[model samples]
Target: MKKLIILILVQVLFTLGFFSISNAQAPKKKQILLIGTFHFNNPGADAVKTDDFDVTTIAAQQELEKITNQIKKFNPNKIFVEWEYYDQKNLDSLYQLYIHNQYESYVEKNFKNKGNYDMYVQNEIFQLAFRAAKKTGLKQVNGMDYPLPMPFDTVMNAIHAAKQDDVMAEISAYTSGMAKEANLKRKTMGLTALIVDLNTEKARKINSGFYIKTLNRAGQTDNFGGAFSVAEWYKRNLYMYSIVQKQIQSSDQRAVILLGSGHVAIIKKFIEDEGLYEVVELKDIMKIK
Candidate 1:
């Protein structure tokens, strides 16, 4: 009995020691600073379009500078933008020009439009991420965007076939109105406040609600199109999260991703679900906490 008792004690000690080493050897989670933003240069291509306010004005430029400075203080090792993943080389080229202070001159000389720096001046990637990258002296802003078929129109057509015009109209009006209201607020609200608001739980829920609740209720039977479309949307976010995870290196302490609010909603959920990284809220960095 004494020998058996001693063996049991020895086993427990070994188990505890093994676990201790395992815990100690585990890598610390890298931090992710996710900033959800409006498309600064609205191309009127989104499902819901708003008249985007200009970021080129002197006052607007100053506000952007303040916001960019806050991002700089995040001290991100990498800055990820929403450009397509396949377009990283092009993005790197543009970023190289911006960092070298020759982006505007190159545009003027090559594009035949001297004053038109819309791509450089009026994009959140150029306005915020590029500026932040330059401040941090990073080599390139990463392009982690991967697009998938959202198929909103097919879902709408299915809803229409199902005689759910009212539901369709309800969803449409609500989303479009939200965009208009945001656009109006942007005209008056400082860019930081607008961005913080865009990343909040309240805002994220509305974006999620479009796929998970509003549209999902619109169809029946063979026309489970809402379910199908939302699935595609979720899949896209999952793939995007995979793209983001692939960019993480063992040496990277933290990275920043500036993406649209709609994408932010699902990817944030992915981060929470996967337990891979510590998320630094945009609000906290901006001191809105």
Candidate 2:
């Protein structure tokens, strides 16, 4: 009877010890910083370089420095950049091709010739980010851009539907609020504002129904253009968010996402909605600082 009592006590102690060890080994959650940047141009300079869409401005440069300082302060474990779904080899190949003026040979043919086409958002952001990331040794830049695998017509139809549903207006208002807070308007605001202003006129037309037949007819022909224009921006942000989440799970490192202002806003909203992450918006932190 004494021996049996001793055995039972030992078994209970072992079970308790196992539970404690399991609890201790559980993985920890990470905090992420989602920062929105304006590419050294003021936040709303969307049409400055119509041919090339250059948005490099004095304010943008200043903003870049500020961003760099913040990243240094945070020192996140990983960094995500706006990129495509290509392997490192393919990415390197693309980079080399662009450098060698051969990017047109295989991918995105005539989409925008580097030589004749003006550098727009991607060019502006990548130049600054690649330089900073290299200098700071934050070498893990992931490309989250998709090649838009649908026909232009299909995309246009989707945009048309989105416009009809007031989705474009919603995006515009969200972007405008951020731009107003920044107090530095540039093409980013211009693009969204254009959409918003047009949609307001549109909403008015629908509500007032002034020449409804003629207006609806005209809208049917010219509709969806504006919506399609902004679709890439919206989709890209979601792609970026997904890639960032994947990176977070793949490694035990916190990530910092440096994307356009429009992207950061939506991504932040989505991340907050997930209720799984502890996200710090640079805007809030800046206010506190």
Candidate 3:
């Protein structure tokens, strides 16, 4: 009886050890944090340049500190920004200056005291991503933007050609409302609240929902411009996400993508579709308004 019991116990131990080894060898999913940030510079480069509020002010700088502190807590392995992917060299070289504490000198030299220098200087890349990277001792901030121009106006052109007056009115209201939301929130709730709103799930859903559902009705029978335009938008975002993927490797356990809020929803969708990464919601890490 003792011999039989000893053999059974040995068999159980072997099975447990095998399972433990398998678990240990299992692949780890990279945790990605997608932070949808408003353009502090408000350069009018994008279709809807949100958040025109001056980030150069002391109050905005203080709020930026809180935002940086929140990102530091995430302790990402890599930090990615919205510059063109091909500009990684230029981006990192500039980041190197920021890291060496020569940011002011570099800015002065590069800008040559140009007008609207404040706009260039106070971009959220400098205020948030660069600051958080230095605080976290990160050596490089990756540029993950793919310069695939989204043909947004094509949908409108199609609608206009089709003479969809009601449709045109609806799109106009949505775009205008987006701009208003930023301005109104900034005035009423301040910078923190504006950012919180920009990063919220409700914000993303509302932004992407139009592209997914309403745009289908944009084009007439001959040309589905609305649907095609939407597909192009997703394609560009997916490519940008791939640029981020190239930067990440097996060793990287976590990463943060600091991008304009417009791009976040589509990339988040791609991340979900892959089912290989765990996304960390920006709102979860942000402080209470």
- lDDT by residue (1-289, candidate 1, tens digit) is 9999999999999999999999999988888999988888887667777877787878778877877787788888888888899989999999999999998788767765544456556889988888889988899899888888678888888888899878888887987898788878987887778888889899899888877777787686777888888888888878887888888787888899889989898899899988878998888877877
Regions of candidate 2 where Cα sits further than 4 Å from its true position: 1-29, 37-62, 87-124, 149-184, 187-240, 249-251, 284-289
Q: Rank the candidates by lDDT, best first.
A: 1, 3, 2
Once model 2 is optimally superposed onto the true structure by TM-score, how far is the C-alpha of residue 82 displaced, in angstroms?
1.8
Task: Report backbone clashes per prediction.
Answer: 0, 13, 0
Q: After superposition, how far is residue 241 of candidate 1 from its true place, in Å?
A: 1.2
Q: Which candidate is the best by lDDT?
A: 1
Error of 3 at 129 (Å): 0.6
**lDDT tens digits by residue: candidate 2, 72-126:** 6666776665556566555555455544556545445554555424333335334
Compare candidates 2 and 3 on TM-score and give the better one: 3
Ordered list by TM-score, greatest first? 1, 3, 2
Give the alpha-carbon lDDT of every model: 0.84, 0.51, 0.83
Write down the TM-score of every candidate: 0.86, 0.48, 0.86
The C-alpha stretches of model 3 lying farther than 4 A from their native spots are 1-28, 49-51, 112-116, 287-289
